[model samples]
Target: MRRVQRVPLDEAARQYLCERQQYARRLLAEDRLRAARFWKDMRETAVFTPVLTALEQMAGPRRRCMYCLDSRGSDVEHFRPKASYPHRMCSWRNLLLCCSDCGRKKGDRFPLDDQGLPLLLDPSADEPWEHLDFDPETGNLTPRFDPTGASSPRGEETVRMLELDQREELALGYQTTYKRLKRELEVALSAGPLDPSALRERLEEADDHGLLPWCLRYGGSTLAPFSTLRQEHPAVWAALSEAV
Candidate 1:
């Protein structure tokens, strides 16, 4: 999961949402006819436009599933499943853009922890790499280990629920990105005289899975090339560390 940039809704869309919200409120208040009219408009626009807009914001050269950040993100997903959380069916924060594979894997499973926090990370609200770690060599995601050696429960649950480790296709996708990133870094290191800024920009361009954060901040500290960079090139390591 990565940081999802939330696009502001246009004025016309905002007005439409206001009208729809009022309609839902009226329906909740027992105005059946009015509520139905509002629901109809809400469904039309909510199902029709917002999803399209979400896709527009989510896709780019590094398009990915909003939830798993593994597969190709292909469609808009409701953060609150329409069937289970119908009241939020049209809410903005309740919607996410995702790939068909993630959509299928997620289905309607929205588990909550004892503290009422969602087990899954909302990429829009949280950075997923914080709780998760990726092994580029294996292309399997694992729960982040704390200083105490205990794994993050949230990350573990998410990996298991989405089968982030077991999914062969997703693993291959990550592996491809991982290999590309490693190659880029290795070239930077071997070039004898490295320009840190230019190298950082190049690495940023190559990063597709938002793995840079996990690499520089977490993955870099222990893992191979990152570790080698950390020990050999302190300035480059520091710059990359802050870049993420």
Candidate 2:
């Protein structure tokens, strides 16, 4: 998953969320809250429409799932399970856009560390590439290895929860995007001295699965096309890296 740049909600939307939170808080305090009912009610409200729209906006034009970035994000997901954290039921920061498959897979399963920190990566709050590693050959996402040769616990949990490494369709999608990105770079390199701005725009257009950040920051830089560019044209690589 890519690091999502969360766009702030408008004053009206913020007010709506605040009111909903207050309502939820009261219900929770009285021990009268039913998580499913509360969420259903929220979805029926007029204010919740704008919240859904805002989430879709954050997911980009295709409305890709925040977790997999493969399927179309069809619903608003609760980062913290609503049944367990009713007080945060309507909190904006607790919401995300997700595909139905991911939503089902992640239902009510929130894992925590020894220190009580969430083991799952919050795309809006954390940089996923830091914890997750991508395999260009298999198009599978696995836990990033640490200096000690162990996988990142958070990444491992996130991948397991979302089944990122096992989904056939997801793997195919990632592979297709990787090939497209590789072809774009190769073509640019063959064309001679690169125009940084033009190259950036072209790559961004071709990066349908948000692989550019992974390519630039992680193991991708050591691979073909990227490695060749970095070695032969340091100036161009620097410019491209900065722009992405």
Candidate 3:
């Protein structure tokens, strides 16, 4: 998954959320809160609608799921399950946009490390490429392995929890996006040295699944067309990388 750029909510919405969070925290402290029911009721209110809109804006034009980036982000997901962390129930950073499938699969299951840190990747907060690696051949995401051959525990847990490597449709969508990105580079390279700005624009437009960062900066950089560009024209490669 690509890193999501979190957008700020309006002052009114932020105040509303803060007030609601205080209410939740109070009830939770008293052991009187039913997290699911409380959130469900608040979700239908006018005040909460703005939060969803802001999340959609963060997901970009396609409104893709923050986790998979494939389906429309229809649900406002709690990064830390509200039932478990009621104090963060209405915190802006604790919310994310997710597809119905992912929402269902993830439910309220949140795993944590020994120190009580989240084992899952927070796309808005974490750099995905640092933990997750793309496999162009299978179009499946795997935990990134370090030079020491140790895989990222967070990435492994995230993939397993979200079933990132098992979804056939998700894999296909990633493959299609990868191919499109590859083609853009191939076409640019074939046309002989072209303006880096134009090429960067084309690549960004074609990067529907947000694979440009992976293709341009990470593992995909070592693959064909991209590697060729880097080798043959280091200056253009630097420009393209800087732009993306």
Q: Which of the numbered candidates is closest to the native, going by highest TM-score? A: 2
Full-model lDDT for every candidate: 0.74, 0.90, 0.90
Displacement of residue 146 (Cα, Å) in model 1 is: 1.3
List ranges where model 3 is wrong by over 4 Å: none
Tell me the tens digit of each residue's lDDT in model 1 across 1-244.
Answer: 6677777777676666566656665665673544334445655654457545655565555567787666677666776665555566557667677888788878888888999888887778877888898877688888889889998888988887778888887778778777777789888888888788988888878777777777777865687787888889988889878877
At residue 147, give the lDDT of candidate 2: 83
Which portions of model 1 show Cα errors greater than 4 Å? 28-51
Residue-level lDDT tens digits of model 2 in 1-244: 8888898898899999899889888888898888898789879888778888889999998899999999999978999999898888889999999999999999999999999999999999998989999998899999999889998999999999999999999999989999998899999999988988888888888887888877865889999888887899889889888766
- What TM-score does candidate 1 reach? 0.85
Candidates in order, TM-scores: namely: 0.85, 0.97, 0.97
Q: Write the per-residue lDDT of candidate 3 for residues 10-82, one digit (tens) a residue.
A: 9999999999989988888798899889999999999888899999899998999999998999999999988
The worst-scoring run of ten residues by lDDT in candidate 1 lies at: 31-40
Looking at candidate 2, the ten consecutive residues that score lowest on lDDT are 208-217
Steric clash pairs (candidate 3): none
